[model samples]
Target: MSASIVCSALGFRWPDGDSVFTDLNLLIGEGRTGLIGVNGSGKSTLLRLLAGELTPASGSISITGELGYLPQTITLDATRRIDDVLGITAQRQALAAIESGRGTEADFGVVGEDWDVEERTRATLDRLGLGHLDLDRTVGAVSGGESVLLALAALLVRRPPVLLLDEPTNNLDLRARRLVHRAVADWPGVLVVVSHDRELLDLVDRIADLREGEVRYYGGNFSDYEAAVAAEQETAHRLVRAAEQDLRRQQREMIEARTKLDRRQRYGQKMSEQKREPKIVMGNRKRAAEVSAGKHRNMHLEKLAEAKDRVKEAEEAVRVDEEIRIRLPHTEVPPGREVLRLSTVELRNGPVLDLDLRGPERIALVGANGSGKTTLLRTIAGTLAPVSGEVALKVPMRWLPQRLDVLDDRLSTIDNVAAAAPDASAQSIRAQLAKFLLRGRKAEQQAGTLSGGERFRASLATLLLAEPAPQLFLLDEPTNNLDLASVAQLTQALTAYAGALVVSSHDIPFLRCLGITRWLHLDTDLTEVDPM
Candidate 1:
């Protein structure tokens, strides 16, 4: 494959003096590449650099083909027509004017070599599941999923040789995701996508893992990468064990050698004191013993040093990802105990819903974006009131909103958690914070300055440590922006949570992993169904 993009000795730093990349190098060839990494690991930054949206602080990037980028969040002018979004308004107007007997040489010039702009636009839109949409329809009339598809259609019309997509499947329903998958499958140009969606990743030709400003390429898909990493880790562990054994053996041998040399020296001193040999002979024997002992000690010391080096090398080869382990006994609920009840509960402009939650039942709420998922969660958390209904809670609750905007930006992580649990001692709070991997100075950093992952941890700590501890949790899109490793940490943290959970998410895989006892599809009405 030919290389479409190359980055050499790249360096990038933020205005706050935070360094993201230092002397980073990469070669992205012609293929559908999947870029994945922990949140805040520079995946999107790299794409931006490739698209010429940002300049590198040092080094250079070379591109052999035209580039297009689709950002994680797509914002379009709602009042504009679809043609405006597709970048074909000029040509469309020229053709229309010519047809209306307003023809001119300039109009013909405008439509010169390519006069099928509208046809191509319609074809691209139809292929992306927007065939029924009129080109003159306003952007506001389309759903979010439709808007995303339209954005992609615009890029496809440009027909750039390289396309970059960041979290393209976010907020998309299953059907929308399928449409995206088909578009990705059929794309013929070089594609670089940064996403956490497993299904989307499966469509890539290879996987590029960005960690700490470095890119590590792995052949095949996510599953293949996991297998390769696992195999490597297994071998590393074996090497570590063997190296440890070797170090112990060397230590034992050194001790025995020292003991033997000391014993021989004492025997020689005893013989000399008893006058068993002549003075000259005794002196010669002592000199010979010293020379031999020095050689032996030096050899042992060298062996010991080598063994230590081996141990260090072996240990350095192993990688262990850290995870948070928590214990929230207060969140546990007993069987047959009512956690929440709702009768004639209706959102302000959404559907009416009735529910009875008991014990630690895990309920999954599925719906498209703007289907009132967040509104319902807010109502359940008592942050929003229903139009005309009653909501009864038998236990305390906490809500993890999609934006993770629970913390005070000006407050440090420790202070945020402390504010939630004012009665708890500082030492107790520190101990709990340590489990989230925020210790000492990290815990003292302001929430506003933390990275995406760090801010999430701080917000979660605040929620989990709140006073009058919550027995029910309402999480709205908890997995939206989390990296895979952070997702794993979240699983570990939630494993210890024995509360009833009402989580609204588009990530079905994550929900299934949480052992959801019931699944509810919230649209015009909330109905129970088999999630699988």
Candidate 2:
């Protein structure tokens, strides 16, 4: 029941003066905690602060035990041996010296009582399905998925009391992801993991949602968190409607009071002019009437103000995740139109492709990390050419690369969209950009500084808003680093897109949401499979 980590009045901001956290306070106890937020919501930054990788601008952090961190983007000396990654190089060297019968007292001290370090490391790696890999092999020789498992194995061997992992499941295949889930499930100490992988999040003890500059805890897995938010939003919307009606009623009552006062004033003026009473008596009556009218107007004014405040409070409680509802009749392909056809296309890895894609077909391209899925996407995007044969595209096509490098970093998002859409006016582009949640100065900010989710949104805007109105969309890992809400937004946007889609992703849920009509597994060849 004790808190393993605590933050009090924690404040931090980037060097560009962009504030991420202000007076943020949190208490993370011992549990499997899933840290989730939008791409640029400072989830990773908070982990860094807790790990002491970055210093906070203000406030303090308290920790009860040793802490370890696995960052979002791991930078490893790929050429180094696996032992070096596991922090056992010194111990292995000591053990070797002792075995050679030339060990000093210092060597014995280094080895200490932990003589089974090598065995434990091997067991951890094997449990993660990396048993086939040689312990002496360099990390550069392994696959990307293997490398992720290796990094996780590195952390597992440490057994730190407090572990912070940022996007640990990113770039991992299905098997590796399941291994990570098991690791999180079996973890005994305080573990906080930040990931977009829904399967991994399903293993957590509780969910901590970082939004609007604070953390809100939900007492279950990702599904529970989503259900809670849905219920809250429904209630908030109902309150907003009720508040709107109350405000209107208050305004109506205020106007009626003013009308009655006006009528009484006019009647009093006529009575005074007709001299219905003595001069002093009429004057006294007028004064009393003036005081009564003033009181009545003030009461109505206060009621109206109170009603307006209630409406504002109710509106503030509702989230503003606006959907992209732009209509693109120009991009819709005819039912009989031939979208793409590959004729005897020889791929890099000996896949002779003969495929035909008709109008508005949604295809999910599934493959392993090194199975040439990305290469195929680049070929379709015209960024790369196959070793032999031609990739024929009958309609205008646009590619959203896995890295999302389509945008110019130095340019603002508004400018980036304008670059892709030369024929559209700036005002028109801004209006469309607002649908992507980039409004006003946010649209004007340089693309280089946007959050991960914001960058994805900006890149998506550029592709969908291109001048030619792309009839074929080539999306690579489109939902990679997106938070759940942003992923929902992306799904809503793609639902409205009336074009053919070829998406490369391992996210089954997201692929299902796309309404994929065809499923193609790209190994040595691209072959269609049943959606089931």
Candidate 3:
């Protein structure tokens, strides 16, 4: 296999004292590559650098094939039609062709080969399960998930030799995720994906772990990478323990030698004084003995330092602490038995849905995109007034909105938290925020500047620690931007929460884990089922 992309001895340091990598090297061949790392480990940074969106501070990155990158955030003009967006790229290329009109007769002869361009575009759309969508549909009317699928379809039409996708499955539903997986599996070129989805990683030929700004290659899928990491950590631990043992032994031996040497020196001086031997000879013998003892002490000291250094090095080789602490606290106040009561609630151009959530029941709002799940959530949370019926929330509700509109774009994280819970003292609020890993000066950073996952966590912290706390939670797409670990953490917290939970999520496994058996499917014809 030929090398498609290569990064040699790369190093980067951002202005915020964050290190991307130091002396990192990687080689990519013609196959699917998966990038896995903890949150904020520079996986996205590396992708940006490879896509020529960001320049590295040092070292070089070279791509052998035509590269096309699909960023985590897809951007499309809201007013533009799908056909216009798709054709814009082709039109630009055709314009370039027209500008450089020095083509041979062969080019003109084969110009008719473009006859099936429309057919090919349709096929691409169908492959993505979006053939039914009108090409003339305005992007503004499309949902977030559809926008992503459309972006992918447009990129595929370019037919570059290499595809670099960053978290392609993040917001996609199960069916859309399957479509992406199929596309990656069947793609005829090099593919590199940065995703936290283990299922998606399983389709890759190799996994590249990004940590501390360096890449460690492991052959095989996610399971293999995890196994290799475990084994390596074990080895590092063993080495550390052995080094500690050797250091202890050496210290004991050194102490004994020093005590014996002291005794010998004292005895020799006493004998010399008692026997009245030649003073010079006695002094010389004593000096030689002292020199030998000093040398021995120095050697032992060097050995001890070396042993300690080895242990430190071994400790740095692997991060053995991987457990998550989900410390969610609830107040003493309990909500009434009636959580939410909705009767004859009709959403615009959508279903008339009715829901009754009693006690601490976990109910999932299940529907396709644009099916008014979020609208229903807003209505129940008292944020949006319904057009037709009434929603009686017996107890005060806390809402994690679909877009987190409560979060201020201009305020710092700490200020945002303060704004939400004005009664809580600064010290207490900071302490609570620290539990979610936003500590020290990070609380002063702008909420808008944080990553999508971090912002979600901050919003969650605000609700969990509210003063007049809400017992009923209305979560909309809570798992949209969370990493897998964070998702698990949130799941554990929600499972432990002793209040009514009404969550709308695309994560099936997460919903199942929450014991949400009842679902209200919102479509033109409303349906409710117990899909336990």
Candidate 4:
């Protein structure tokens, strides 16, 4: 069997003097593999490199089979129909030819010899839970999740030997996610998936962890890999501590030896100054003591140097997890009983919905694609006026739009924070930003120049620095572009916040972790579920 992909000494660096990877080596065989790393650790960049969409700065990459890629972001034309978009026309032709029992040259060209393209298309679509999709429906009319499913369908038609997917289940619901898992398991070719979903990671045969421009492979599923990493980190920490103790002991010994040598030299000088009888004997005694002291001092110095080296080695080997410092001012305002109330709310061309939110309630809005979850949040935030409803908000609310529309590209992170938090003093605003891990000069950098994770941090700085921050937080897809570190930080901060939290996300595990007090599930209408 040939290798699916082989990358040796692969490396890449950006024009801004930032290195993504260096001297990286990887081998992908015919099996399900999971790629795990922090955001900006070059997961997507590596995928693109594998797909031949990007060139490696150095080294070599070889691929034996045809490769297909599904990027995290899919670009679909608004006017094209779903079937036309996925090349189903050829499939229809193949179907017609089979039913008529007629063989033509065009049929051979449309679909290669033995493969029944139409039957395959039907099977693939059905596996993706999209068999009922209207073939003529415009891409513009489809929801984000629908477009994602359609893109996968298009990829299925290629029937490539190697498949690379970036965040394949990002916008998928539970059912759709299960379908994707089934497809991946049934795939006969090589598969490399980059995702944060632990359930998906468990399905892979092995795990590759990207860190500090290198890939470390573990021959097991996610659970085994995670356990191994934890054990390694623990051992590293132990080594660091032991090395530190050894260095301290050596330093104390060296200090004592130096003190003894200095005292002996002083006594010898005093004896010479006396200039009494037996000058040769005094000189011999002084010289012998000096020699012994010198030898002892040299030995002590050598031990000290060795200890320092050991300490340095241990420090270099230790690694700590990254955390985001998202800090907001502590407010003492006594929140009212009713945070928000919606009565007789009806969306355009949709069903009637009513909601009552009490003090500091954490609510999760759930729905399929094209549902009015976003619309309801916007109406509550006073961005979009509802067609007909009685909406009430007791306190000031800050809305984090799905796309983070409030950020200014031209302004620096500090300047943007200053603009949103005008009432806050410069020192206070800077302090708040530091909590979000945008420290010192980074806060002064322009917002447009930051990475996706940094940009998210900058936005958080702006929102959290505001004086008397809106007690009611409305976030839509807050975890979309964040890295794993940032996601953890955000989760911790939200968990500790005392204000009312309302968010909409497709991340099932993250939502469950947030302890959503009330869940409102909407298809064409709204249905509330009790705590599970």
Candidate 5:
């Protein structure tokens, strides 16, 4: 298929004057394209540019047809009806007026050719597994996943030839995610999605990796992309090794040349001391020898510089996947130790829950969106009071909410961690932060200035490194907006934590990676479920 979207010499910068993309060119053709990149690689920004939500500072964007965009964060007015959220309230009202025999020319014009708007809306909703939803229902009454589906349904109803989805599966449950995956798989026109969801990416026809302000396309899905990247990395490593060896060889040659030149100069000085030649002849020879030496030294220096440049270039091709290495010995919960208990707990606008967690049990909280997973976590963390119940914690606890709002944006990452571990010295905290991948000047950067991944690592460090170390950890949707590499790092970090973990998440693969001993599905009641 021909290119459906084209970006030529695109340039963009944040209001703070931090450049995101410069002279970037990209082409997206007809098919499902999964856009993958490390966090802060301008994936979301590029989507916004394509969707017309953001304008490039330079160059142009060309689209063959109308565009539909679903933003990462879906925010709708709580008071608005579903029809309003779908952008069809006016058309619905116009249809009602015509059916009531009070139709005006303007009302007819408002509806235009969409005489079957309600039918189309219902059909779209049904396709998204939202057939039960009434158009009159308020947006607040729906779950977060339903809200995302509603937004997608709206886009589907429009039938735009070009669709841009930014983390569409974020905060969505398994069932909801499958619905989205099906829709993406069935899309006929150009579809470009920026997502960290591997399953969603697997449904795409191709993968677009954005790195170092460049886009490289790979045929097939995410798995295919990974394989290709692995092969490329191996080659890059080999090149790096070869370049380093060349650099070392140049250094050794330069040293040998210098030594030989020194020996020749000493011999000439000895001959002159013995008065083997006339004074004028000796002076001319000395000047000639100095000029020759200078030429030889410059040549070696030039070769060394070239070798160093080659090494740098080769190393740049190798991908960086830094691991978070930290041990939480204090967070360990011994066997048979009671961690937490909830007795006859009734969550606000949610099902009653009863749970007795003991030892270092890792529990995976799985449930559909709006099933009160977040509410239960909050109640356990004592951030939200249950409508009626008793929550007992036998040990220190730390909660990492989905929003990751635990850190103070005004403070540096080091200071943020310091707030959590007040008794720990700054030097110690800085060292621990380095284990979380925040090293040196990075730990000193203000939290507000950090990227999404950096902010997450900082927040995680604060939680895990807190004083009076937490024995029970509650993480809610921790992998929602994380890049694939960040997810791996998080999994690695959690692997070292010996605390009892109660994590509520829709990411099945991530939960599996956590080695969860128990899987609980929250619905009308919490019940033990088979680990998928």
Candidate 6:
């Protein structure tokens, strides 16, 4: 396979002079590649550089053909028509003009050979599960997931040789995610996708792990890459252990050498003080002994230094996947305790239904893109009034929206949590924040300056450490855009929560990790469904 995207000596830095990549070189060949890394590791930055959306501080990018990019945040003008977004409004107009016998030479030239562009566009939309959308519809009329699909459909219609997608499956429901997975699987050209969706990643031909400003390729899907990494980590751990043992041994030997030198010096001093030989001969012997001892001490010191260096190098090879350690005993509800109740409730633009939650039930909300999962969550949380119904909460609740806007941007992470728990002392809040991996300077940093992972952690800490100890939690698309490690950390934190959870998300793998007790499908109505 020939290379489709080539980056040479690529370097990029933020305006604040924080370098993301330096002297990075990469070559992506003709196949689907999943680009994965922790948040702020520059996976999305690399994609933007490849798409020419961002200029590199130093280096060059060469693409074999036309490049198409779908950014992580798809912001389309509300007034723009779908045809305009697809770049086919002019062709469609020209075709209509020719059919009405009002076509000019310029219109004919624009139409060229794409007379069937409308048909092709419709087919692409259908493939992406957006067939309900019409070319004349405004961008604002669709859901967020639909907007993403629309952008992807535009790329498919153009049939660019290189396609770059950043978090493409985010905000999409399961059905839409499947559609994207199919599209990625069937892509014939070079496709580089930056996504945290494991299911979507499993469809790729290879995995490109971007870490420490370098890209390492694994010859398979996400699972294969994970297995390879696990093996490498096992070896790394073994090497660290061996290096540590060697370091300890070197320290012991150095200590023993010092002890022997001290004993030798004491005996030599006694012999010289006792006048056992002529003063001149004794002085020369003492000088020779000192030289020998010095050489021995230096040799041991050098060995010890070498051993410490080896240990440091070996330890650096290991990767750290920190887990969130938190215990919320106060949030636990007794068995059979009523946590929440919705009596004949009509959700805003959603289903009308009655629901009851007891104890610590973990419910998974599933639906299509426009199926009103988010609306239902908001309604349950009392942020949005239902059309006509009653929502009664027996216990305190907290809502974590997909946008993660719960934190005050201007407030420090610790202060944000303090705002949620005004009764808690600053020391107590800092202790809790440390469990969420926000400690010391990180806890003092403003929410606006935190990275994606750090922001999510801070937002989560605010919720999980809030006053009143929430017993019912409503989380909407909680795992969107989260890296695998952050997802794991989230799982760890949520696992420790002894509260009722109503989570709306399309990520099946993450839902499974949550140990969901009940699965609810939101559509025309809310219905209990089997685990997916």
Q: Using lDDT as the measure, which candidate wins?
A: 5
Candidate 6 local lDDT, 1-532, one digit each (tens): 3549988999999999999999998989899999998888899888888877789999988888888999999888999999999999999999999999999999999999888999999999989888888789788778787888889999999999889999898877788889899999999999999998999898888999899998899999999999999999999999999999999999999999899989988988998889888999988988998999999989998999999999999989899878898999988989899999899899778579889999999999998877888888888887899999899999999999989999999999989998899999999999999999999999999999998999999999899889899999989988887898899899999999999999998899999999999999988888999998
Question: For candidate 2, what is the lDDT?
Answer: 0.87
Q: In each prediction, how many residue pairs overlap at the backbone (N, C-alpha, C within less than 3 A)?
A: 0, 0, 2, 2, 0, 0
Q: In angstroms, how far off is 472's CA in candidate 6? A: 1.0
Q: Is candidate 5 or candidate 6 better by lDDT?
A: 5
**TM-score, structure 2 vs. true:** 0.91
The estimated TM-scores of all candidates read 0.91, 0.91, 0.80, 0.89, 0.88, 0.92
Candidate 3 lDDT trough over 10 residues, lowest sum: 324-333
TM-score of 6: 0.92
Question: What ordering of candidates by TM-score runs from best to worst?
Answer: 6, 1, 2, 4, 5, 3
Q: Which segments of candidate 1 are over 4 A away from where they belong? A: 1-3, 78-80, 94-115, 137-146
Predictions: Cα RMSD each:
2.7, 2.8, 5.1, 3.1, 3.4, 2.8
- Model 4: residues >4 Å from true position, as ranges? 14-19, 77-115, 134-142, 275-295, 325-336, 530-532
CA lDDT, candidate 2, residue 470: 90
Model 1: lDDT equals: 0.88
User: What local lDDT score does residue 100 receive in model 5, on the 0 to 100 scale?
Assistant: 100
- How well is each residue in 1-532 modelled by candidate 2, as lDDT tens digits? 4549899999999999999899899889988999998777889899999999889999999988888888887777789988889888889899999999989999999988889988998899889998887767777777777777788888888888899999888877656777888999999999999988887888898999888788899989988988999999999999999999999999999899999989988998999899888999888888998999999989999999999999999999898877767677777998868999887877776677777899999999887778878878777777778888778899999988878899999999999988898889999999999988899988999999997878888998999999899999998888887887788888987888899999888887789899999999887778888883
**Model 1 lDDT per residue over 152-195, tens place:** 99999988888999999888876678788888878888899998
Sorted by lDDT (best first), the order is: 5, 6, 1, 2, 4, 3
Residue 52 Cα positional deviation in candidate 4, in Å, after optimal superposition: 1.1
Candidate 1 lDDT for residue 36: 91
Between candidates 1 and 5, name the one with more favorable TM-score.
Answer: 1
Q: Where does candidate 6 clash, by residue pair? A: none
